[model samples]
Target: MTFDPVMPGIVLAVAAATLLALRAVALLPAARAGRTSVARWAVTTVALLLLVLAAARPVTGSAAGERNAQRPQEGANIYFLVDRSSDSAIPDFGDAPRITAMRSDIEEVIRAHPDARFAIIGFAARPSIDWPLSADAWSLQPAVDALTPYPGIDSTEVNAAAAANILRYQLISAGQQFPQAENLVYYLGSGAGESTVPQGVFDTPRIDDGAVLGYGTGPGEARLREIAGQLGLPYVPRRDGAELPSDRAPESGTATATDPATAPQPTELYWVLTMLATALLLVEIYLTTRDLRRTRAVRRQAPS
Candidate 1:
C-alpha cells in the first residue's frame, strides 16, 4: 500500500491521534452511562482516519504494478536523421529549398504523432544531435526550424563518411538513451551524394521499425534507394504536391499519448476510501442527534 499525502503521512497520523485524544477527554463522561459518546467517538475516529487515508492516496498493488505505475506508458521513439549537407539547400520541391520541405515534413510528423517521443539528428560534414531523445516535441521545433546547410564544403553533395558516421553514432546513442523503448528511425535526405566510407564499414543498429524518406526526384533518388536497401529499411521518396506514403506516417487522431507522470489512473482506491468516509460521517451525525433527542425527552419526563 502506498500513500501520497498532501503533508507527510506521519504528520497526518500524529494530528489525527492528537485530535482523537482531545475528543476522548471531552466525551468520556457519557461513556459510563449510555456508551453513546464512545460509539460516536469510534465512528468519528474511523471517518477521520479514512479521510486521512484518502488524503494520503493509499494504493495497494503488486511491486511490479506499482513500479509500472510510476513509469511513462510504453510508446515508440521516433528519431529523425536529417541531412544538412550543402545539397539539401538545392531548390527542389516547388521553388523552396529541400531543407525547407524537410522541416515542414518533420513538423507534420510531430503533429501526427502527438503521443510519441522524438529526437533529431542533423548530418553533413559531421553528424550532430539537434535534439536528444525527449517527450517534449515543442523543444524540438526551434532546432528543426533553424536548420541551415552546412557551409565551407568543397562540393554541394552529401558527405557520405560524415552521414554514415553520424548515423551509426546516433543509433547507438538512442539505444543507450532509451534502452527499453521501441524506436523508429526516419532518414530524411536527397540520397544523391556518396560517402567516402566503404560499404559495410559503418555498423547499423538493430532497428525495430523505420523508413528511409528521400526528398527530390533527381540522381540522388537511386542512391537513397541503395542506402535504404543497404540498411534493410523501406524507402519512400517525396515529390512536389505528392502525399507522403501512408505506411511511413501515422494517420490523424490515432495518437495515444501518456498523461503526466504524477497523474493517477481511474483505478486508484482513493475513491472507495472517500465513499466509506462519507457513509461513516453520516451515520455518526444521525446517531449523535438521536441520542441528544432521547436525553432531552428523558429530562422533560423526569419530576422537576
Candidate 2:
C-alpha cells in the first residue's frame, strides 16, 4: 500500500507500539491471567494494523502512471463513469445494452485521444476505480469493456455525488486540471430521477467533460433489441422525457435489429472480493470483546 501521508506506515507502527505500551499498565489480574492479556494485546494490534493499511491507500501493483510523469499528450484526460446496476445488462439496440454501446464509445474516445490519459469509475456496487489514469488504450479498453453493474446497485436518481467522485478521481490521477480548459468531462448513465446529492459533492469544482452518454432514455425504461434471435446485439431506442437521446438512437420497438451475442463482457471486480476478506476480521473483533466482558464478570464474582 502506498502511503501518501508522511511516513504513514511508521506513524501507524508507532501508534501500535504505543497501544502495546499502554496495555503494559493494565490491572494485575487482567495482565497476569493465563496469557489472556497477551492474546488481547496481539489481537487488537493486528486489527489496528489492518485498518491502518487500508488508510495508507495501497494500490494494486503500482500503476505505471506514477512513472509516466506527464508528457505532452494530444487529447485531454478522458474518463468514463458507468452505471453497473442491473439496467446496464439489458439490451439497448440489437442484443447489447446501452451500457455496452457506452463502453464502445468510451474506447473510441481513448483511441481518438491516444495521448490523453484515461481512467474509469464504476458508480454502483461501491464507487471505485477500474484502472488508473494511463495512456495504454489496449489495457484501458478491456477494463472498460468488462465492467458489469453489480447486483442490486442500480440507481437512476441523478447521482451528481457519484459523478463528482468520478470526475475528481480522473483529474487527480492525471495530476492536472482537466480538459486543458478546452476538453470535455464525460458522464455515462441515467441521471434523470435523482433529485438531491446528500453529500453535496457537486458543489466542488467539476470539469464538464462535454456531454452525457446516458445509458437509458426515459424513466424506468431501459431498451435494447435482439439480433434476429442470434449472437449479435444492436441499439434499441427508449423515448423517455428525462434524457436527450443520443444521435445514434435505438431502433423503434417494431424495427428489426441484429443481435450478435458478442463475447460475454468481462468485469474486473477483485476489489469487491477484498472487502469480503475484511468481514471475517470484524467477527474476530466481536469475539474478542465478548470474551473480555465474560472474563471481567467472572472476576467480579470470585471471592478474594
Candidate 3:
C-alpha cells in the first residue's frame, strides 16, 4: 500500500483537521438545541474523515505486483544513437533536412513504447550522451528537439562509428545491471562517413532488437546500410511520404498481453472512499432533516 496524496501531507492534514473543527463548531448549537442528535454529528464526522482519506489517494498492491507494474514490458531499454554529423544537415529527405526526419521518427518511437526506458546519444565531432536512460519517456523530447547538425568547420570528416565504443560500453553496463532486460538500439543517421573504427563494434549480443533508420537518399545511404549490417540490425530508409515499417513491434518474450504479471495493476482506491463518504453524507442529511421536522412539529403542537 502507498499514498499519492492530492496535496502536500502537512497541508492536507491541517486542512482536514481545520475542516472537522469548523464543522463541529458550526453544528454544536444544533446539537445542543435538540435539532441534531449525537448520531448525526458522528455520521457527519465520519463522512468528512472518509472524504479526507479519499483525497489521500491510497494505492494497494502486493510487493511483486508493484514491481511488475513499474517494470516495462520485458524490462526493455530503448537507446537512440543519433547522428549529428554535417551530413545530417543535407536536405535530401524530400527537401527537409535529415534532422527533421530523425526528430519525427524519434518521436514516433517514443510514442510506440510508452513504458520503455529511453536514452539518447548524439555523435558529431565526438560522441556525447544527450539524454541518460529514463523511464519518463516524454522528458527526452527537449533533448531530441534540440539536436542540430554538427558544425562542418569543427571536423574535416564525419565518422559514423565515433560513438560505437561509448555505445558498446553503455550496452555492457546495461546488461550487467539488468541481465534479464532487452536492449533495443535505434541508430538514426545519414551514414556519410567512413568507418574509422574496426568492424563488429556494435555486433554485441546485448542488442536484442532495433533498426537503422536512414534519413536521406544520398550516396551515404549505402554506407548507412553497411553500418546497419555491422550492428546486425535492419536498415530502413525514410522517404518524404512513406510510412515507417511496422517490424519493430512492442511485444517481447514473457511480456505478452495474456501474462497476468504484465497486466496493469489497480493503483487507485480513492473512488471507493469517495463513494462511501457520499453515502455517509446522505445518511447525515436524512437524519438532520428528520430531526428538524420533528422538533418543528413538537413546537407547533405545544405553543401556537
On TM-score, the leading prediction is 3
* Stretches of candidate 3 exceeding 4 Å from the true structure: 1-65, 68-74, 152-155, 193-203, 248-304
TM-score of each: 0.55, 0.44, 0.59
Give residue 160's lDDT in candidate 1 (0 to 100).
42
lDDT of 1 by residue, 73-102 (tens): 445678788888877888877888889888
Give the per-residue lDDT digits (tens) of candidate 3, residues 243-268: 76744554465345324455454456
For TM-score, candidate 2 versus 3, the one ahead is: 3
Q: Worst 10-residue stretch by lDDT in candidate 2?
A: 223-232
The sequence of per-residue lDDT tens digits that candidate 2 reaches over residues 1-304 is: 2222223468867876776676556535556775765565555555555555544444333432332222332345556666666656668547777676766666666655544557677764346777655544555666876887666543543343355555555555444543332234455655323333342233224443344455565542221121101112223333322333332222466321111131121232333434643664666678788989999999999999
Off by over 4 Å in 2: 1-74, 154-160, 169-183, 192-201, 204-209, 220-304
Best by lDDT: 3
Model 2 C-alpha RMSD to native: 13.0
Q: How accurate is candidate 1 locally (lDDT)?
A: 0.69
lDDT per model vs. reference:
0.69, 0.50, 0.74
Q: What is the lDDT of residue 276 in candidate 1?
A: 94
Clash count for candidate 1 is 2
How many clashing pairs does model 3 include? 0
